[model samples]
Target: MPIESPSRRHVLQASLTVASSALFARAGAQGLTGPAYEVSPWPGPLTAFSLVDTSGKTWRPADFKGRAVLLNFWASWCEPCRAEMPTLQQMADLYGPEQLLVLAINFKEAPARALQFAKRTGITLPVLLDVDGQAARRWGVKVFPTTLAIDRHGQPRLRVQGEMDWTGKAAEKLIASLL
Candidate 1:
């Protein structure tokens, strides 16, 4: 019998499982009956990013300085991501781009596939391509459908892991705080 080291993939998977379980447990303990938005006040400025959307427009955090930004990291294969997308679009419509900008960052997916999903779902939100997943990695997005809410001054306010109804009361409250 030989002692073998765990592979990198196994280690990463185990880490993610533990993290997700802990997050859910914390949410339950907090009596979070509404949407689970983990209040994460960033100690510093917003994370720097430069990504291109499906329409080939380069976007950066500074580009949307005066408006609250919702950065959603999603993939076409994620069912929850697919389900929550429409609500995100609705939120964008409700607030308008001047007040709130919702950018859908596709995780490690092809631009064509993401564009197809947007077209099929009739989503009008700008779909940014994270082809190398660097943006997600930079933002520390380990879970699928993680959304970070940034305030008008380009500061991160809260992070929500998993799917959430953007039209719900809790979501409205969160959005209100950002705006």
Candidate 2:
């Protein structure tokens, strides 16, 4: 008998787990200490990509130059992503428009689903639709709640795996350090 290949969701989950573990290990080695969020700095410049929001607005890295960015990749079915929505909203309210830019990238989901989820959760932050998961793939996102902090220069400074308390001091400290 032949073994069946894992489903895409299963494969994604496994790869995300391994990648997250590696990110944590590297963070530990770098003497990073804080909350459960892992911080892995990008070695070089950020890759360019574009995705449209539900409003048919396209956003790219260049669009947010000179401002810090909180780039979150999520899906409507993800519990952690759902749970973190409020905190993300808080972050947006606290440091937005002029200070920080918060973008929630909906992965491999329809615009309607994402829009409904955002509406139900009252998440007013910009929700960019990654309809085909291509943008997520390019960003090396294998998990539901992967978040990256991009500095003013449009470079990724840290990648946080798993859920995070965006309204908390640790997160504030991390973002403040970038700004």
TM-score of 1: 0.78
Superposed Cα deviation of residue 176, candidate 2 (Å): 0.6
Q: How many steric overlaps does candidate 2 have?
A: 0
Q: Which residue pairs come into collision in candidate 2?
A: none
Off by over 4 Å in 2: 1-36
Candidate 2 CA-lDDT value: 0.83
Query: What are the per-residue Cα lDDT tens digits for candidate 1 across 3-105?
Result: 5567966888999999999999998888665654444554434667789999999998778879999999999999989999999999999999999999999
lDDT of 2 by residue, 19-99 (tens): 999999999887576554566775535777878998899898779978998889999788888888799899889887568
The window of 10 residues in a row where model 1 has the poorest summed lDDT is: 36-45
Error of 2 at 6 (Å): 48
